[model samples]
Target chain A: MQNKLHYEFEHQAMATQFSIQIVGEEYEDAETASMLCFQRLDALELVLSRFVPDSDISRINRMKSGDELLLDFETWDVLKKAIAIHQKTDGAFDIGVAEYVDVFRATKQGILSDFEMVNALQSVFKKAQNASIYVDPETPKIYCVQEGMTFDLGAIGKGFALDQLSELLEELSIKNYVINAGNSSVLAKGVSKNASCWSFPISSAREEFAVQLNNSAVSATGTFFQGDHIFDPRIGQNICNSMYERVWVSSQSAALSDAYSTACFLLEKEQFNELLQNNSEIAWIAISENGKIQFFTQKNIPLAQYLIS
Target chain B: MLAGTGLVLANPFTASASVLSANDKVNVAIVGCGGRGSGMIFNNIPKIPSANLVAVCDIVESRREKARDRFYTLFDKKIKAYENFYEMLEKENLDAVVLATPDFWHMQHSVDAMEAGLHVYCEKAMSNKLEDAKKMAQVMKKTGKLLQIGRQRRSNDRYRFTHQILLEREKMFGRLTHAMGQWNRSKIWTMKPNKQDKIDISKLKQYGFDTVDQVYNWRNYTKLGGGVVSDLGSHQIDIFNWFLGSYPHTIYATGNNSYFNFEQADTMATILEYDTPNGPAIGIYENISNSRAIGVYERFIGDNGAFIISEGKDNKIYRESRVKSDVWQKYIDAGYISNMADMKKYKAKQSGDSGIMETAPQISYNINEMRDMDKVYNLPAHTAHLYNFIESVRGEETLNYDAETSYKSEVCIYKIHEAINAGGAKVTIDPLEYIV
Candidate 1:
């Protein structure tokens, strides 16, 4: 293990940051592999960065009011996944919320009048029904039957990145590693310097470092910074901030962990508990609004069990 | 006279003003004083001057006692404890509200605090989801309230410095063609089920039950929280947008509940594409649930050179100076190497940890680049950002990371999730989409 070539690379992505640690047999080979992984990630960003003007997504957004745009491979791919999650969660999770929400944002910035914003958002909602979106996996084409339709992927992009990074790492034959998009979404394959499983502290201690971690998925989606900013697009109202407010999902893939955490956060109690019952592997600890920290898991594992075991 | 509790700084912007004047103190009240609320109490108290903990509110009496005791022990401050957050807000007359509540309650508490004419320092990921984020922003605007998001990175120096260097410079990072970041964790393990006898069992399906598992562990389920992406990814993705100069044009993602068979995906990956005026850039990100082989805390790659950043850790830059590489040998022979070298040599450089802590040195172009205070500051941009925000509020300078700039990151992260949900397809990131 000591002789094994392990290289670590760090990049600022998502909003937080990322640290990628890869271990292989040769140092030069590992560094090259890390570089390759970084390059692949770069390619992924080119096709997707919203800041770019000519990007496929940006072009679509820049399309004139009546213009019809052809969807790119990556855009179409995101549309398909959105539909699946929306369907799976019975629309509990929907990217369509962006259409209504952006108008609200403009209004707050004084770019749009309140009435204009409302009317504009209502127009979008009305057109939403007319908007026909279809993705053909064969040709990988995403077509919008209605010109008014728009797609948003704020919920699951990190997961997709994780999957891509994982495949890239695997392709590089780099076996023991982890790629984290910001401590929230991550892909981990092996243990760390410590022999024990990586332990993530659930308390709101604000420590910059992790406690103990090795070969496990941990994600905490707590409304720590922005208050009830996550509005349900279905209804342009803020959802109730629950006592059990943070959703930490642990799974095999960081993508899954990130996605499920988002999905679960959107789900109600019956749906959430039902999913937990069916899937016993994931466990969550939430800090209640009442200052009580509760634990919900498929099993009866206590916080103490993980903390002190 | 700032006649409220928690008025720690005279003003973050105007450094000329004495922040720790013996008479100037910030009187604050902690709502939902649990782990996070208490943690915030500890985290900020030491940084600010004379921040008196005026009150503590918690639904649980015992928890309130624990907080009060801790506050007393930590700062020798007597805290008035309460059972209801609303009651505390109505009566406390605090300078600010530290809303350390759950995802669902953040909106209400923040709105209430703002309406009460108090400054609010809320925690990260903003609200649980997009709607909540918007509402919170709206309320802040309407109230003209000093709403400081708990995204400490907004206050940290490391993150801000990178944004300045990569963005403000003349394509200094060389068109920032590609970027990738990740957060890897070991086994987060499991939280034990709350004892069944504590409360109503049927309420587990409700939106706001106070059960141990339901309230404290509500984030594990959906309705109560926005999952890990909204919770954790929001922060990092926000940084991505800030440094990249805009939102992601396209995004694609996927995840599974393989490890923690919860309703949500425990682990996931995202691919974000940025469309520059020149061409395109890409960002690849990831989050894992089960394993903990943490690596590459943060990396920003560009056409000319790349930068690697970490919090409280050294941020290093590695130039793609291998101009004579196999693929680039032809270009090198064609005179691209000389121009590249000249550009690289002239770029302003400030490699280390931007005066936060001694780390590695940052390499950039020449003295011209050094003029921009942002790059000179480098990562840990949060410190400057906080100071800026306070300064803006205190009539010092404008808050650079206002709703608009902050929204850029929001829109980008949302686009990434949207793109990935489409099975790694592309999607428009512009805000002017034809409605829904």
Candidate 2:
């Protein structure tokens, strides 16, 4: 019989396929751990997914002005991360821009006139720009000061789930594992079967780079899935012209990597260096309009490194 | 704080706070301190302003202490922790206790809490044994105190709307004919103990657990829990009873340890015969252990229309093609159902031949709750269930699923288990078995 040292389990959640690959453990043990982890992921979706009707995000969307709603700790943890990233990215990564995002999606179906798309953007621009949501640092309490702040966590939820799963892996005492969500987000911890770091390829239209990752996450963000147009919620402008063809970001947590990659797509070339400097631990790669790929990483980062090209 | 005891004093109903009057709030303590119990403490209780958490109890000392510490870390509030149940009841002046223990412990814990003059909200499949479940319900009637079972969907906004408005008042699905539900998990495996937990073997045996694996995965064992039928079927099967307003008179079930040698059925299917007010309807339910196909949901079919709903993301309303669009147009106007994507119009738009709306081509509709209903239940299902119980404790509203009503579903559930064990024999039930 061939020896089996690794077990793989796949779960679908948050509109993306998630996978857990555990190594150096018995098949049944790894399978059970993965099942329990998937159970946690499913539980998180019940509280986090917007389409679930009774999710905390859905409840938050139905909140009125001055509503002080307490949230699930998991939901609160994600929202707290989202709000912080919203500030760090200077509003390029905003969940409140869902109304604007929906319009762009609608324009893709070929039913809406160009004029209608433009009009829709201008109308919700004010709401998206002025949207404010606050969280109590002491508790997972949301203070909704503005009404009708629609949110879609499509940008960061998968990464958040991966981050939570990594912690679960540590608790399960599984020393080595790799988790991938939707093929866009990946989190790695410990080592692989061969004792090297877990590795995956990050690619764009013209080039690909193999990344060695452990105890960190790498997230690739692009607009090729639904539509090419992405709105920079800060100015409510469709940055499809200026948006990068692809962006990849690596950080200590997938939640950060996911948010920053999406945010990096809307950033100007000059803003990249400063944002990288501000977040010294984070590294990124961006494919510009011309298909030229740029890579950046801080010194002393060993695990999450790409061959500089 | 209780003098000489580790338990915290439960705030009396007259205790006032910053937000609501003390009279409006109910002092609640949670037992179990496990996964579901932690969810109640963090996900549900915090959202209900009228439910004040006073203490937590668990047979596992570390679990209770960890829950207490986690609570203080998250909310900046202190809560008492205890390892013994009777000690907690003797010390904390609680108005209610939320029990999220193993199925075998539910009856004893719930009955004790009710006898102590405290309202109780216990998780479902009331007990592993049918008789134990009936005993808990009987105590609920004898004590005259509130006892709400945690069949949370009974309080879900979407579910309640489907039952109260679409099915009952509007008769949206005329003459319910059939119902189906499934919980398709990929694998049935035993749980591994959390390495971080400090398990005390001697303490565990007092609660009928001799190993950490048993405590972590009680539902996988027959002696401690009701197996897959309790873990998953209890929730979805309860939905059928609630929507149909009657119990199944006959059950035919088949299952085997196809993949695992666990005591419970690894893969099981049951056919329930329900005599509904509409007519005699058949309900089919299944739990698959080796494959996660088609996911989990409850589908209710009738002559006029059928709708599939779940606590997860599988909720959609479908109309029979023969029924004209105008028949559901009023439901859309009433906010009971909305956004029907007529395939004819959708395909026409897809081909650029019409100005009609473009959507996926299906006789599918997106069901919606009324804006007013949305406002009232802007909380998680468990939070809504817990809120309903707290409200009942405060005399503001009655329970969504009291113990006596939930026992009806448990009666059907245990019968399904029996049929599975008897090699899929057809078992007939007397209607009197459903009543406590």
Candidate 3:
């Protein structure tokens, strides 16, 4: 027997699986809303996916120096958030490290020889030094003043998609729902019939916990999920000596939770403590490499207040 | 309208239409504020620099208003909204209209727009009924206006390059013997009733829908759509007729209304037999509403090589092992195609391999035009299709998939529907039937 009488639907987009659960809605209505949401997601993928040749991101990647391209509004929205996160994290989270990330990934997959890997890294570092991309604040336009940079939204794309879906759900009058993007970023709204909040099991190297979510989002990133592919873009190197094994960010917005979870993972313990102090509303959980656990939150924060095993 | 040609024009808005001068922006309106219509309003139309979306029309008042408000918020431009098509036609000063409504409405909306001295980019399968689709082409001929059917692949740079440069020019896929395609979906779309819908049920009947579900999930209903065959198969079948350079001489199909169990809808698997200039060939297509296995793409195979192309991810060209690698070196050097990998050449000088010898990967190549175009996302095929229509309106470029050519593809699609509906029967099509 199930505790909730909700409908669940799954879709694939942004190269990841996504699932939506609608609570207390009629099946016909839930299915319809999900289908529409998936369609919107597909459209977003077309505009956002780098693999999509004519997508705004791909066009931006291929732009010459001093080239400007009008962007799809959705891409513009994502870039706006990404720029904010990049600034707030003070270079810890950067989308411009796509070249370096690609080299590291290829090296990890055994596709690059030792000599080729060093040369590739050196080449990307030189390119990064000379490249800077900007988004138009007033319109959906991206300008590449010194082009030769690529961007991959794999870090925050699904979270951004969840936030967009949440808007659509609100338009559809679907108030009570839980939506997840491949279980990495999840947004919960309202309360289900049987439970006061939605709960998802989360883990790191050792510590296991579940966060109860209501009208909020939880995003986690670590070796458990990201598999050491996480790179510190500021230094042009990997996070070889990280204080934490896994970290989760709980925010009212999925895009924030997702992007910052990564930023938080890359941040040192002191830097994260400072970030927490600056953003009082954001709560976090960290599982250390040695299996120690920590929670940073307020007294009544949903994540801390409703923490479960 | 035409200097007193003894015919009264149906449009009350304008007299005779003048050709848009070079560099003149096209005033456009989109009718049918449904899913596809919303896509055009939100995604495609906004991307085209030469298009000015001035108005929108839908039978559902809320949908029309929502589309208008959303378009304004996203693009920072206000557009008028109308619940009736004729009112939008009469009030809005427009050069063209995009018909993204249900398949049943494509013909009527297209004919009305053409009659109103406006170019049209109508979504395809053209119409639910063959006669209606044929009538739409006839109206285009009568109006002498441009009609670009939404077989968007026809305008895709990859598909165009594959057909025109590779297959036709370089003979990449030599002596084309067979082609196959599939459009598989996990489930048929079923939309929920709008919670904020304010329209009266009586008014819904005026839009060719009995209930709101029919309006929302039109493809599942017989009266509003032609089910899986026409809805999904049409796009791929059009490619078969196009890339093969001829319409199918005969079609055989099998399908069942087992899943979803909608009144008259069915899952279809069809085989279209064609006689091409190269030789006789078979084009196989299947549209399954229940399983999304293999995704959506079209594949064409020949003696020399084979290639698969789609608006989605599948884009690859394979060389036959029986053919010498030197035969393709010229193409690679000319930037026609690039070798994906040359393992045989790499292994000739490299170290030894593992004991287990796996299946050798297909020596594949990718078309270069597609590659270069893929490097930039400025002119997606859908946007290019609309651009082609607007450019044609300005006399800059002719229509790529004109009404008559699209009508020919429809003749083949409708025959597949007929063959399936008749329980796997083989339907022969006279080549004259495709002449419109």
Candidate closest to the true structure, highest TM-score = 3
As a whole number from 0 to 100, the lDDT of residue A12 in candidate 2 is 80
For all predictions, the C-alpha RMSD in Å is 27.4, 7.0, 8.7
lDDT of 2 by residue, A220-270 (tens): 877678468666777877765655777888887998899888888888877
lDDT of each: 0.55, 0.79, 0.77
Kept native contacts, fraction for each prediction? 0.00, 0.21, 0.16
CAPRI level of candidate 1: incorrect
lDDT of 1: 0.55
Residue A243 deviation, candidate 3, in Å?
A: 3.7
Q: In candidate 2, what are the lDDT values of residues B1-436, reduced to their tens digit? A: 1112100112212322332224456889999887799889877887788988999998777778888998887777799998888999999989999999999999998998899899999998799999999999999999999999998988888888788778888888898888999999878756765556677888888878878888988888899999988889999989998888888999999998767888788888999998898789999999988887789999999999898998888888888877898888888777666552211222223334435455524446766555445336767788899999999999888888999899989988889988989998999999888889
Stretches of candidate 2 exceeding 4 Å from the true structure: A1-8, A23-32, A65-68, A100-123, A126-138, A143-145, A172-176, A195-197, A204-208, A223-227, A234-243, A286-292, A298-309, B1-24, B340-360, B371-375
Highest lDDT, which number?
2
Interface RMSD of 1: 25.8
What's the best-to-worst order under lDDT?
A: 2, 3, 1
lDDT of 3 by residue, B1-436 (tens): 1121110112222232211222469999998888778878886777666778899988888899999999877777889998888888888889999888888988888888898898898988789999999999999999998888987878777777777778888787788888899987888776666787667789888888899778777888888888877777888888888889988998988888888799655577888899999889999888778877678989999999898888776778888888898888888777677653211221222222422333434457765534333222346677778877887888877888998998898888788778877989999998889887
List ranges where model 3 is wrong by over 4 Å. A1-4, A97-111, A204-206, A239-242, A279-281, A298-309, B1-23, B336-363, B368-377
Q: Of 1 and 2, which scores higher on TM-score?
A: 2
DockQ of 1: 0.01
Query: Which wins on lDDT, candidate 1 or candidate 3?
Result: 3
lDDT of 1 at A176: 76
Q: How well does each candidate superpose onto the true structure, as a TM-score? A: 0.47, 0.88, 0.89
